[model samples]
Target: MTNFEEDISVYNFVSILGECFQNKASVNLVKHYPTGRMLAVKRFHLDKIWDNISIVQQEITLTKQLQHPNIITYYTSFVHGPEVFAVSPLQAFGSCKSLLDSHFNEGLPELAIILIFKDIIEAVNYLHKSGFIHRAIRASHILISASGKASLSGLHYACPLVINGRWQRAVHSFPLSTQPNLNWLSPELLEQNLKGYNEKSDIYSLGILCCELANGREPFADVDSTLMLVEKVRGCIPGLLDCTTLPSKCDDRECQGDCDIEISLSRRGFSQYLHEFCYMCLEREAKDRPSAAELLTHPVFTLVNKGISLPELLKPVLPLSDKVSPNKEMCHLDHVLHMSEMDMPSCDWDFPIS
Candidate 1:
């Protein structure tokens, strides 16, 4: 067996839940003592703890503040000497990566692809509405739960907003690392020309994640980080090798102008609506990209067949007694303003209700 499997055995783990990309952490499915309930333990080594403390803190803070079914639920956190750990519900199917790897050969059915993308977009829209930007969005960071639901994980790089009048900038202390995964970074981030990454960066990463989901491969799997950086600077978008066959003259060229032809051809599996969403997300100019709220209202998510507005589809039908209290509404608005300021947006929304 491999060293990883040996390590898993040593940990007395029931199963290896998932492997992280940077080797910074690992998630294991283990039986909790006494209760014997299954749980996911995210273990980060002591050596990387100092560098990752902010990340752990961010995860804790963000999870506590944002409550959504599609977002990964944080059960608890603990510290054992230099090592820090966070426990969440175990996902039986592992990550989106595992699913793609196992099913790629057979190809993903259209219904399955639609379901996955819908889940991911919902999670992302929730984060955006809550005033958080998930800087690291990739296939590995998305978990497929036992109930066949997709949940987003990893918020170490998430930026909280701090609103100052009509302007926003990311919280000052949570510094951007010199080395970030360039493969999934947007063009503005690669050039370091962008002052702050707002919701749009998350959108760009989502586009890459969509590419991975449809093709069963990482968007730029073969390219090294440096080359990926170079390619991104030259406006070279990544393409997919595997795609579902479509009828002739499908006109999948909806997202054509954003990148080189190679990238466009690879995205044939995506519908025109999905293509447009990805294109808006991958826009080189941040201002050109759609907001999370806007994305939630897109035709891909709208209940067009039923003639229902996007908001109507997302509206909760709870009884009046369970409606949001005035105090809670104020708190949520305050949080949104704070987030908008940190994002450094030109204007902030002043809700009429407030």
Candidate 2:
């Protein structure tokens, strides 16, 4: 039997769901015959794993160690020849990216953004406490389960800040195979300097995510990446768009996507609390960024209604629980411009001899 057949026969896997993250992996819907429970099986084609098979091994190992409600639940895994399968709860609503593509093309309502990011930030806090840097955090990496819970996925790029019982102040190397996530990456990480970067890098990325959900597109996404990098290194900040921030017109589309705007000055029709929160996350200096724990208490998040329900917020677009079917048609990878095409600027850094 082929690896997939062997997997289906052994684990009762069924219904090939769809692909995600540039088609590098595919998600399968499986029903556990013993309990008749449903699960999401992520199959990784080892050949497509950028860094040998070790990274997939690292992902599985790290996922097993995590046990937060807002984090994806990893059940088990098995290596069938060159393919590795990771089983988890099926997120019927799919990824936040898919939601953006299907329902909220004009960007999610601010309240919805709050509810979603609340879960994401809490998940980040958990990882930070565990001494792990989630090097790749973005909209697409967040999946919404049948309960309307947003769980943080994409631990494949995560790494430890604690090395050999010592807490390392900085991580000199960037996570490999994160080319598609460059826009969401922190500037300090892109700088690739000797000083290296720390957990604050995640904060910067979080700020970018705030702008992404608020504006319906990633901040600075319309421009060439090299220019965006230069802009970021030079301290240009992206912010929330509104009637005030957007230019009168971009011919047909609104004039958007320049990273140079100041976040603090924006009165962009959005709540001031949220505006300040984004500003705090996008601080030019990494040290100026707040920790994940600190951000959880921000008034922007505190303002959310006590009775907030993601399922209630997302009514017309209900979960895919009614039936299992292919979702690749709406996975939203088309607009994800790959950074591998961009020429990377030279950086000076010392390579630690292993």
Candidate 3:
């Protein structure tokens, strides 16, 4: 039998109610025969033994460290033979990817898109505050819960903060044969210099996700992979193509240079606030890009809030019962908060690596 068939057989007696979603990394669904209530099962393929060890270890470690409602809860992890399995709260509505696919032919509701973005940003901020960086932040990683709440999943790419006071770069390099989602990569990552990627890269990816939401289609859908990479490296900006009620310019530029204002004016339009948020995220300069925490306070995000502070906005709606022990949470939170508050007493926000 195939790996999937073998894995399904083990959980087969549990009776899968339905297939909720499937992605490059996981298949999510609710099961019934094992119990009367709903449950989320994430089945990981162990046949590809190349990176399974590290991915599995990171998933368990990251899940244990994170505690937020916007993050999908990790109930338990089990090793059944060669396959690794994890159980969490199942979201009946599936993922943002599924929703976007269904509505691509038409269009997603602006409010729904805003709400989803808010949840994603809040989740990322929480992760950053907790001293973890989710290297992979995409539509498929977001789960729309049964109650319509968006939660982030897929911690396999997450990495803990290196305590050596060095800014470690991402080690997960994409192969040349596999075309990367250039629309989601920051210019720094796409550049030939091979400059290391950091949290700012995640922000760039988030900007692409926003574009997808606004246009109701994948960013650079028609562009071939090679041309997409070239444009990305050359700083080709993407604009909304679906809605005509917004503005033409993607964002305000202090200097228009030689570019024709008329051409800029003819581009697709989007909500001014949303466009600004996307532009800030897509900024070529990493330092200019807002941190996830700062983005939570931006006008685009704050405009949708009733009266929530950044910390409050970072809090998840779900209870922390599914999280690791309170003591562990406190330790992790304390360390992260302390690190965040640390200011270089001598170097003006710069730390010397030695």
Candidate 4:
């Protein structure tokens, strides 16, 4: 607080480079005029801040307590007038959702997903050990650091299970504005029943995250919310799409395509281990899902190429340092890179991949 150089405020940082999707519209990208350093400053709306002040304070307190390499920590936060500014480092690649929008529309490579998920699961494991549940764990909440580290953020919805110094069975409260995360939420959380839900709910969301990363689209994209909810409760599970799961192109109605089911490992798209992992994650009963720590031991993670770095797997996608400027125009021009558009099955979540 003594030196102005260490301080970040509206006066020192100038202009909004881009809007941050982490907390919807509350965070903005600001650049320091002299050093040309960019950072995100989170500012809640004055009118809405009063209504959600408890949640805001809870997020700040939780961030200070939850320290992990994979979790996002703030540089400093101070109140200026009616707004509170929480400044943090600018992730070079932005949120994974941005990546899906600019590049990698057909999902990221398997190695890249492994690298990112490993970091995210580590964070989730830490939170679970600390008796907290990160209600939001979707791709949109994940950011790729300049050094290829994945950071789990958007902690406003995170809540603690330890109340009155006692570990509770489950939490009955629902997350605010649940619509955006409806597709990824566990059935119990959506059901809001007296039985309640526990940290296992987050594991279910994590499973949906895998499917999202692998398939390059939401698990229940464009489906009716009411119908999706009903199906999810009735044991409808989404999966990582690949040749192993999808029916053969040559569909003989009479034969029912059952005879050609046995395919070589080389011809199959994703490995059997991945399918099994997803199956465990998407188990209809919350108790059936594996814990974050348990999931880390799965063989699918063994496929991670330890030899190659995450940045290498993300070829042709330049980090901010590689770019000339933060200008949206310069960053979005897709002239040099060529991406393969995945011809994913256009059916709904009910698509019979068998």
Candidate 5:
């Protein structure tokens, strides 16, 4: 038997869960041989770490330092022959993006959205205060538990925003080119003219992510990444509203003849506080955007008070079913095929959420 299979024998490989592109990690659901506890294991093939060892190492280092309710718990990591592994609690609900794609294809209830966003912003704020910048803040990086509590994941792109207790303005090197999905990146990152992006870049992504949650798809879905970069550089912004938020009827059809009735109605339909908060995050100029801490106080978050309870929040969304059957090999192959067909990018600026 191959060393990979030999090492993995300690656990019953139930199924494949997901991937971590930067670290060359494939998350798998496995049952511990000893206690029979099920866990998600992110296996990183060391063969791919020739020179990029630091990138994978950074994820392990940063994750070990993080301890928060909304951040994924890093259980343990160990090298096993040709590969390395980082184990964490299984997120039965999967990522927000996957869940949205599968179940809530039209977008979630506003209360649910607010609850998820609140947890995310709070986690991000904690990270920033602890001197880290979760450069990636997309929907795919947000993992939901069976209880419906959201936690941030995908920390491979994370880096320190502060140095020696002071916030730094620029980074010395460019991010890896293999990283895909530049559509969610901020203008500062795409332009590459600015010294470098900082924490504010994440807020911009958060704004886009909010729109994604509302629309059930990525923004600029029809545009090419290169063209999207041009528009962002040219000061163009995406509309936050989608069909779900717009009104079905327009009373005044005459005066609204030239005006976009849906757009007008959507504007009025959105929660004023939430809309304004999202607008603040999408500010073109990085400095104009509010920091994570400042955003926590926005009316959208503050007014929610005690949001939906975890049990209630999880009820509408069922846990991801185990597709595994008697033929384990076929189940694994099926998962690989399913993942390959997804339009989700290989790497899109991951920031820590859980």
Candidate 6:
């Protein structure tokens, strides 16, 4: 019997539900036959793992050690012949990127953005405390739940940001075979370096992600990766808020009057604070950037009204995703533009590497 069949026979797991990320890992919808508790079983084929066995083992090791409210829960994992299976609570709402594509195309509301980032910041802070850096932080890596809670995902690129309990600079020599989303990489990480980068690099990527959430797209996604690297090293920042629109009172699509102009001016001020928040995240100096813990308490996050829940914002659009196929081509080019055409085991998870 195949590894998958053996796992099913031993664990009594249900069938596959969906597949996501560039890795093509199957997200299986399973249930504990005894208790009927639902689960998301992620199956990674061992044959495909090949030489990356150590990385996969590390991913499982690191995931097992993490426990945070904003981080996805890693229930358990086991090897069944040639396959490894990780089980966690299924996020029915899918990824934040899928939400953006299906709904909220104009960008999330300021309050919603603040709440989501606050959760993400808390998760990143926890990771830093554990002495690791989530090298890749992006909208696609942030998964949302039916309850509207946002958790950080994509831990495959995770590595030690500190050594012997001391924060240290580490450099990575990117392999020509693999292409990453260069826009999210901090300037220091993109440079030819011997000193390398640290947890602060994750902070830089967080800043870019904030802009992405506010604008409903990855920043500088249209530029070629090589050119992006040069621009980043030159202290160029992504124009995250430049394209954002202010909340308007006009019910109609088209309106022209002194009242409309007055309304525009009044509403423009609403996003000013959010713009400043993004600016704080996009600071050119990594040292100048606030730590994840510090950013959690920023004034911008205070804008989230306790009375309003993020689920309300996601309710309308979440159901729309059920009708669409995950493999269906995204109509928006900007959403997937940063993703390379190459085929490799893509990794991004709030819990274990996906």
lDDT agreement with native, every candidate: 0.56, 0.73, 0.56, 0.70, 0.69, 0.66
TM-score of each: 0.66, 0.82, 0.67, 0.81, 0.78, 0.78
Task: State the lDDT of candidate 6 residue by residue for 186-221, as single tens digits.
Answer: 888778587667778888888788767766677776
Candidate 1 positional error at 258, Å: 24
| CA-RMSD of model 6 | 8.4
Of 1 and 3, the candidate ahead on TM-score is 3
lDDT of 5: 0.69
Better of 1 and 6 by lDDT: 6
| Model 1 lDDT per residue over 1-354, tens place | 111221222233443333342445555445554344556666666675566566567667777677888888766666655455666666655566555555442234434555566777798888876777777777767766555567777666676655653435433332365343456767666666537556677778877876666665556667788777777778775533323332223455675453333453445565566666666777676788777667767776542343422223212322122332433322222343243224232111100000
Write one digit per residue (lDDT tens) for candidate 4, span 1-354: 322133433323333334332232244445645556666556554454676677677777887788898888776677756556676666777677767666876677777887888899999999999999888778878888778999888687787899999998899988875766889899889889999999999999988998888767778887899999998989899888666666545446576443343222113476677778778988999999999999889888888867878888887788764563445322221221111122222111000000
Model 3, residue 44: distance off in Å is 2.9
Stretches of candidate 5 exceeding 4 Å from the true structure: 1-10, 22-24, 49-51, 163-166, 177-179, 243-269, 302-307, 310-316, 321-354
Clashing pairs in 2: none
Give the per-residue lDDT of model 5 (tens digit) for 1-354.
112233455666665555566535567677666665666777666776657678778777888888999998767778777677776777777788876777666555566778888899989999887877776777888887777778987676777777787778665344564245466778887777757777788889888888788667767877877888888888786655644456555677685752463454354345677678778888888899999989888878665557556446545656644443445542243454365346554322222322
Candidate 4 to native Cα RMSD, angstroms: 8.7
On the 0 to 100 scale, the lDDT of residue 340 in model 3 is: 26
Candidate 4 — which residues are off by over 4 angstroms?
A: 1-6, 9-17, 20-26, 31-37, 248-268, 324-354
lDDT of 1 at 241: 36
TM-score of structure candidate 1: 0.66
Best by lDDT: 2
